[model samples]
Target: MENKKALVFGSVLLSGILTFSLYGIGSSIASDDSKHEHDREYEYRDKGTNYSTKSVGTNKLYMEECGSCHMAYPAQLLPTQSWQKVMLGLEDHFGENAELDAESHNSIESYLVQSAARRKGESRKLLRNLGNKTPLRITELPYFIYEHDEIPCRFITGNDKVSSLSQCSACHQNAEKGRFDEDDVVIPGIGRWDD
Candidate 1:
């Protein structure tokens, strides 16, 4: 009777351990699924609209001057100081004709400064990808460089729409709206990243 009782007790303990392990595994999987769902919802929210409520000055300058040959560089790509430097050097802007009237230039500068990259918190994907150094040029972004690194350098020069690497909006669909996530990246000729 003692042996039988011991056997029964052992079996009960084993069953309890098995049940607890299964429950733990199941709960972990459920937690992962919930996290994935949350990520999906965040991506959905980012895809809502491309309209910006910020100052129209930058957009105006971009459309009028920069948009003719290539897509406008997103304001968030550079820190305010860099934008200030770029604005100050409009006459010799990256080997192109970026000269503008005094009023228009001031407006553009103001807009760029207001939406500077330095203002981004650590939580922002751009800041995370950028790491330590503040990127002055729009093309200097780690993600942007990584995404375009595979493309032949000649392609940028040959393509009128993407003359320079700075023209992110030329390829990325939601660039103007300040959304640079992996999901939003859609190259003009190239479809999408396999990953």
Candidate 2:
């Protein structure tokens, strides 16, 4: 009778473990699906063909010039006034040494100013951090700093693909296409458990 009771107890314990493991797996899958749906909805609702390849003038300059090195700084990352400051300081761009032609410079400046961070709605974390203040340096961006806090300084400078800490998408999985959620982050050379 004792042996039979032990057998039943073991079976129940095993069943509980299996149930918990399956629940965890199911929850992870459901979370992934929700995130995917959110991204899809954001893309569909925020459509305006202009930010894409069809962008002209300064927008083109951003893609052709800036994008060559890193993801184009999202227009919503800075207030409109801040974008103006950055555009005006293009001659002294942080490190790339950008020197734009007058027409291209004006075009890019206009596009950036028009789509400045101020114009963005409250949905963006970057904009939220700005808090009505116009920031001059992209590095000053709160969201940028928060996202990069985990990255080691050596990796950022050592990696060829990543020149500055501002390049979030370089290591982050969904960064190339403009998704920076925590779930989307997959640090290279690190295991999921580490994350």
Candidate 3:
């Protein structure tokens, strides 16, 4: 009877471990699914067009430093190398003295690299048309040009509300939240962006 009881206890413990392991695995998968739900929904609804999947999340240091000057543009918008170039040239950041302390610079660089577009799935297309060129500006990306090709200059550079295409949040209402669904765009002065 003693031996039987011990076996039963061991079996129960093993079962519990298996159950917990499965639960953890399932939770990880579910988390990933929820994270990319926006991407999946957009693809389903749009049929062919695509947008960069937002980063896993944002970094506070990056937001505080870069965002204080310009909208903390989503890091996923650029490739790893591009982000490296941008961070490396902070002293001459678009003709401004945007250099940061070593600690802050390192932190921001890591965040950007981790969040940058890897050459996978739709991200591969993001690097398309660029033959080994590491573009420092998001506006210089080929994909960016292709997407905004339709918008007239008058609506961007000419419009006071939107000084340039760099002001993503100007038209993309949810840009700061890493959501750039074309449907949500509301170009200021102009109503909704049909294109």
Candidate 4:
């Protein structure tokens, strides 16, 4: 009977030690993750803005269809009129047949229209320098051009990893989240963008 009691006590003690060890490891891992997130936020804050937390929401159908070919840019990047034009010309979308079924097209159109950049809001900066022109391409927007004008062509077209400025994800790590802060840019072969 004494041996049985000793065995039981040993088992419980071993279990407690194992549980404590696992808990410590888990806590350490969680702390590391928190540190990483803090560092990322600090980097964005240091850049004079905090676009790192932006989230434009998401659409399943839109991501499945449009995102399959290219980055499904945040709808706020364009205006309602521009999205309408793009949807109307899906048969020749940027030199490709991107037409969708009526059901899919209508749904996607509604989503884009609802989230398009408004004349007054977070997207107003994207609409600047426009004098009643409907641009079908985000890259053609005056604000976009102005933001990228300083980047040399060689760093883009010449760099195999980044064929064009249209591929926002190629440089902007958080492009999918609607975060285009300058500090988030890291050109493929070159490095972090200083200019």
Report the lDDT tens digits of candidate 3 across residue range 1-195: 999999999999999999999999999999998887755423212111232333222377788999999998877788999999998899999999899999888877877887677676445656778779999998999988988999999999999999999999999888887766777799999979876
Candidate 1 local lDDT, 169-190, one digit each (tens): 6665666655555666655555
Off by over 4 Å in 4: 1-58
Clashing pairs in 4: none
CA RMSD of all predictions: 11.2, 10.1, 10.4, 7.4
True-structure lDDT of candidate 2: 0.65
- Point out where model 3 deviates above 4 Å: 1-58
lDDT agreement with native, every candidate: 0.64, 0.65, 0.79, 0.82
Residue pair clashes in candidate 2: 58-107, 58-108
TM-score for candidate 1: 0.54
| TM-score sort, best first | 4, 3, 2, 1
The deviation in Å at residue 131 for candidate 1 is 7.5
Full-model lDDT, candidate 3: 0.79
TM-score of each: 0.54, 0.61, 0.71, 0.71
